[model samples]
Target: MSVTEYRQASAFGKRREPHTVIIARGDDIRHFTIRPWLAAFVGSVLAAMAIGYLLATSYLVLRDDLLGATAARQARMQQAYEDRISMLRAQVDRITSRQILDQQLVESKVSELLARQSQLTQRHGRIGPILDRVKGEAGGLPESAPLPASKPELRAANQPVIYADSSAASFWSKRPAPSGPETAADRADRLFVAINQSLRAIESEQMDGIGTLTENAFKTADEIASALEAAGLPVDIDTDDEAVGGPLLPIDAGMIFEARVRELDEALEKLETLKAIAKEMPIHNPAPGKPVTSSFGVRRDPIIKRPAMHAGIDFRAPTGTEIKSAGAGKVIKAGWNGGYGRMVEIDHGNGLTTRYAHMSRIRVSQGDTVDTGDVVGEAGSTGRSTGPHLHYEVRRNGTAIDPLRFLKAGKAIGKLL
Candidate 1:
């Protein structure tokens, strides 16, 4: 046990010897012997183990760095994805807000349009009667449907319907034409513009029609007034009497139709006044289809053999021919008169009077109201040397004027009546 022994061995054609290792500590020595082959084997084993350990250490260190880098990269990727999502969300929110604002604006526009529709409807009602009354005289306006001509609802369950042009001052034009592709809102807006333009055109037409009617009415009234003026009668119509006293209610600036309506009303009132006066005068023929046999003038008296003033015209007919009043009036005198058989007299106010002489039978009594064409008497030959005929006189204040003048004037304005 104290001596080391080694057996000889052959390796790679060389004789191998045992290797020795000695250790000394504090003068106590120890020695160990190893065979050469064994030593080489052990050295090889140790080198392999060192190499394996170094490789394992390097792999662990590299793996930690790789894991840390990978984690950082993943975190960066997650943060970037979230940032993209946030940006998209913000854009969506902005778009939603804008859409909401647009919806509200559209709703406001719809409300304003509804109000205008109501206004236009009221206007139609106001002028309906006036339009009817002037149909015959002033070429009638075209009949149209009531205003606000569309449905009131501007939205459906899923989408909004943006139509109905409003009366707001700003809505006078069709604005902000749609671009890109046509949407429901765009289509509805187009419809609104078309409707608005069409309705406004109708309103414009109405205004024009009323203006024309007023002009024609004024013209007719002027004609009547001129005719009456030539007959020693003056028409007195106060058309522009500004005796208005009321609260200062301001109207919308867009209400130009009101002025037009007022003008038409004044014109109509004036025409009505003149027409009433014209009707009251001796305008209609007392005897329809009756021809005048004798004209009123200084002529040879058939029975007196001298030239005398013939103050009335004579209409020869059968003795029992019906006679009528020349105008609307109150009967002043009726029945027998000196040399004029059964006579009838009418006082058409304003100092105008008419007489029907040589009547066999008088139908109207004193104080009886008689309209134009009313049967007042029957024609007869009881006047001074007159055959079966009617003697008609138009006198003013008891003096005879040319009955032809009144007749001509009546014929001139007959169509207007």
Candidate 2:
């Protein structure tokens, strides 16, 4: 067919035209066509569209799965946080309870200390005055005065709260697992440290107070001993020397201090004994009122014209005046003796002895125990005397000393005399 007639017929029949072209490159010529090219381009575009659609669908599905996983992780984190909060609240409650118990224990200790202080105050009447003197002295103390006690050392908080990551990525770290705030052993150790510190502080304060008291007591004893020595009583305050060449007679300040300390210890023991006895002893007087006329030691003897040694003092009273035991003792002698008519000698402990001479009648017999102020005899001048009087004498180890010393030391001379 002719080209014009074929093209017209193909156009009229609605069929596409097929064309071929020849291209020359260098020495070679290549033939190219259009109908097969269109077919190949269309097939490639469809394949590309299908591949892109598949990729888009896979991406959407994967994104949806990731969102759901993220939501689940958030829920788990919330739950874990709630659990940690609950655990922290429990730990706080435990800590609070322990703090309350510690406070109660501290209050109990404070109450005990206060009670002890009160008891000590009552036992030592001079303590108040001494404390006042000390305070006055302290008021003028230098600013650089030594501090004997200081604050205690406190330990740092070794344990701290730690939060755990719930994510699986970090679950297997080699570090140790988190523990609670504080364990029972930790609290016990802290409490023990606190108690030890408190005890040390108390000990320091007590030692300081005792040192001050001992110093003052020694000073007073020294003054008293000096006065007594000046009074020509042959008074020497000395401790038993153990060393061979130790001062045969120590009258120095050191010896005086040692003696004073020993006496103070003895006095404390005696005070305790006296407190016990005061609880049981009768408060009322059981003896008749016998008026005392003469005092102890170095008095004029009526029978002897010359100056003579009068061992005991005389109490001028009626013949029926009752004689009493001054303190608790056992009766040793209640019969007659030379120069003393109808005398009763009572032996109290601690080398103390009392004798009641010139009695009209004897109420207690020998080997009888009598308490303080117990009626032992009736007052009368039964011995070689001029008038009706009772002779009273106090002796230490069978040697006559001043009876007034005990009466004065007892601070109850008015009641007895």
- TM-score, every prediction: 0.76, 0.35
Per-residue lDDT of candidate 1, residues 1-417 (tens digit): 112222223324555445788999989999899877787898999999999999999999899899999999999999999999999999999989978987886787677667766766777777777766565444312233112212222233344323223553346344555567898666666556555554455555566666776777777778878887876665888756598788977776356677777777777777778777888888667777889988889988888779999998888778888998888999999988987777999999888899999888898799999988899998888858448889899999999987888888888777666
Please state the error at residue 117 of candidate 1 in Å.
0.3
Q: Name the best candidate (by TM-score).
A: 1
Worst 10 residues of 1 by lDDT: 145-154
For candidate 2, write residues 310-352 as lDDT tens digits: 7766666878877777778799999887678889998876566
Q: Cα lDDT of model 1 overall?
A: 0.75
Q: Count the clashes in each prediction.
A: 1, 0
Model 2 ranges off by over 4 Å: 1-272, 276-291, 412-417
